[model samples]
Target: MEEKFDAIVVGAGPAGSACGYTLAKAGLNTLVVERGKFPGAKNMWGGAYYGPFLHELFPNFWEEAPVERYIKHRKFSFLTEDSALSVDFTTKKFDEPPYNGFSVLRAKFDRWLASKAEQAGAIVASGLQGDDLLWEGSKVSGIKAGGDDLPADVVVVCDGANSILAEKAGLRGDLSPKDMKQGVKEVIQLPREVIEQRFNLNGKEGIAWESLGTFTKGIPGGAFIYTNEDSLSIGVVVQLNALAEKNVKANDLLEEYKQHPEVASFLKDGKMVEYSAHLIPVSGKAMMPTLYGDGILVAGDAAAMTLATGLALEGANFAIASGAAAAETIIEAKKTGDFSKTTLSRYQTRLEQSFVLKDLETFKKAPHFLENPRLYEKYPEFVCDMAEKIFTNDGKPREKTMKLLKQAMDGRISFLQIIQDLWQIKRSI
Candidate 1:
């Protein structure tokens, strides 16, 4: 007979780690199985993490976690063929304690987090990919992995974005290609002093820049730059369907983005460090899978919690928070010995009650809205053209600003279309 535990977490990411930590802290038997050689061995992100959730899980997380830098500034830019229209902001409040966000390399952070769970008493085993869910008459009985099976009253799937287990169990369906954002990322290295001097940083303070311009070559994705301790993480994410339709290869696009006049300046002397690619669940609300099944719960990117709002790709916080919730729900299920869909549904309720669901539901349109073809192609060009006209002082009397704006709109977008766009923007955003 397979040994039974209170809970089994399949995937030692933030969500799984959080759940395991909670269960173990409650003194219940818990086992976490991971496919990677170590937790986060395969995870990647353009990755920005909100610090509060981690701080809540382990107070003074900054004192121990492998964080890159504390971000105090954020920049957004519109890029054209030659010029850029940009806005930048810096706040000292963000530079201090209770820092809002930080950059991370998923590999180091995820492993550290899983270790925390282990210390808290959860058994964490790597290279044990969650292979199948053992079902006893429509109820999740346990998790089978690494050619062996272990029993559990409840199993949580935090297996991540392209979860084969979630789909096989009929909790999620195959993802539509258009619903995902395929991204290629590279971490570039520069000397610490060089980064501080170039970005004007003080100690561990950092800056982040996000762009919606020529980065994707109008294929409907964006580029981002974040300052790390001694390196810069920069990359582009494009809509997959748009790429195939445009006959664009992912690597070639990254090369073009890096060479753009505005983007190139930042990399003047910085050397390329690491290159990686991963898929992101870009359709926030539209893509979420069923939250619960008999004795099973889903969290993190596996549940489609990443919000792709303008300039922000948020998933890590969602991972940690939802993971905690799943853990808490299981504790209650353990008390009543009722791991049926009815009892396990509490995980869904807690997740929905948390900001994880509220925020994701609120910005349901942002993912597709940012990817809307017109915003990627028409608006950036229109803004650039308008900027070109106003900044041009050729010694001749220039047309009125409104007249220039109209000219910029003429061939690119019609007056009627602009009116419709404004309405859609107002409604969706």
Candidate 2:
């Protein structure tokens, strides 16, 4: 007879580990499976995790977690071919305890998080791929891995954005390219003091910078630079459909972005340490998979919980929240000895009542709004040109600001179009 567990979580990423941690802490027999040699070995991101979700889970998690730096500064820039305009902000409040966010290498963070689940009594099985689901009739019963069946009362699907289990469970179909973003990042090593001095920081203070413009070649995505303790994570995230339509490569765009004067100034002596690429689910409510079914639940990227408003791209917190909610729903089901779809559907209700779904629903229009081509092409050029005209003192009679604005708008973008775009931005973000 094969041993069965109360719950099995597929994928040891943020969602899976969080789910396993919560379930095991609740005294349930839980197992977490990861295809990678360890958690986060196959993961990559811009190197930042925001919000208080981790604190809620571990209470001052940053103290013991392998966090690089706390973000005290943020910069957003619009880059034209040869010029840049930016908005930079920093505050002492973000430097206080329980900071707003921190920069982290997923290779370190995910392993630590998986360890937390393990310490809480969840059996973490690394390098174990969950190839298929075991079903008894119409209900999910367990997972089949390495030609062996591991039975469980419930299976939490936290696989990833490209989750095969989600499709096998009839929760979602093949993901559309138009709804995904491809991110390519390079971890550039710099001295810790050099990183702090270059980005203007002191003692664990860090920066997250995002740029939009010709770098992506009008592909409806952007570039990012995040400061780690002794390194920088620089990358570009571009829309998949747009990349194909424009016949452009994301890595080429990253090279172009790196060569930009504004960006190069910060990377003078850095050594390239790591390179990675991954897919992101940009469409929030648009591509969301079915959250629950009989004997199964989906969370994190598998459920399309990422939020990509033009101002920010966030997903880790949503993943953690959804994982906890899934565990909570299962705990309730265990009490009633009912693992039916009706009982598991409380997972969706719990998420709906929490910040996860509320935020995604609130910014549901953002993804479509960000798809506008003008944002990646014309606006950056117009803004930079207008700023240049305003600041340049050529010893001629000065033109009014409105005249410079009109000059910038001429042949690039119309005032009515700007008004409409502004309105769209208002509604979307």
Candidate 3:
């Protein structure tokens, strides 16, 4: 089709759809070209959808969007071979009107968000993967897909992790294995009532858990369990090089994780329903690519914008927010009839101004800190050993805590090493 659009969005994810929806709603001719058979047909997430950002674009989204549950509690457990040290936070505040966040299946959510864009007049066309951006004198002019060229004044590539377009456009360099994370997750099924009673969830209120410490077999990765209505999303995220070097199968690690005394109980009656895995970039702020260039802007995972080291993993929120800012920038450029590098640069400037970039910048060292090996290996074993000794009652003589601590430290780590770890942690976080 020999046609042109005001903007073309690549990838029908949160970021792409948000930009498409905003531009279309503002009456800009927008086209969303997705590679998948349908929007979100191939996306996988722990299924957490933070609300306000979506609500800002589609008010009353909860009433229309396919949501699994409104999260009421969050739990993080540090697990060892046979034990777990955990922390939990629950509040009814999340149950109120403006809910905090909800569990979501990316398959349904991505389609729905794209549909919203379609509803707002954006032409969301699927099965057309944006192979590359069409250039006009050092500036992006449009996109080429499936032997057909679709022209656009501005192109927003929300192409997700392993973005081919970003590299083709010289927006990102080759992604190193060390800079990526391999995530394997399974959706396990159970009767709703059984799940509700077992997890202490009433109605749609659910729990989320992130685990570390020996879960990755001394590898720099972590495990997690997220509760849904009648199923649970459980998985592990390991740094690529860590997993490759250990020659560990992600499934095997998952099996061991489920065998842990703390994890076993949760899977007692649950049956595996679906298996999924994907790689995410999480080398911290250093891995993020240049956000924009002449006539083109990148958002979402394509830009390596997810915060993997936090109380909760954040990708969708950043995706939508950056997408919106990109749309805002495009609108300004459109008004001025200038899609030049100088005018389009507002995309980068605004992203830096937003909390998405700021937070990613702030936690820049967090991924490296979390990958320090000790947090998941040495400290956990040490902590579990201390727990065993402190709980033992038939000791010949009660040992002082300091003596026990030093003894524990002496084996694999030293006092100076622990202190240095502490210092590095303080500096990173």
Write down the lDDT that model 1 would get.
0.85
TM-score of 3: 0.95
Q: Can you give the lDDT of residue 4 in candidate 3?
A: 90
369-415, model 2: which lDDT tens digit per residue? Answer: 99999999899999999999998999999999999999999999998
Supply the global lDDT for candidate 2.
Answer: 0.94
| Number of the top-ranking candidate, with TM-score as the measure | 2
TM-score of each: 0.96, 0.99, 0.95
What are the Cα lDDT values of the candidates?
0.85, 0.94, 0.86
Highest-lDDT candidate: 2
Of the two candidates 2 and 3, the one with more favorable TM-score, higher being better, is 2
| Tens-digit lDDT string for candidate 3 (330-428) | 988999889887898888889889888888888888887877888888888787777767777984888999888877677778888889988987877
Tell me the alpha-carbon RMSD of every candidate. Answer: 1.5, 0.7, 1.7
Off by over 4 Å in 2: none
Better of 1 and 2 by lDDT: 2
Distance from true location, Cα of 64 in model 3, Å: 2.4
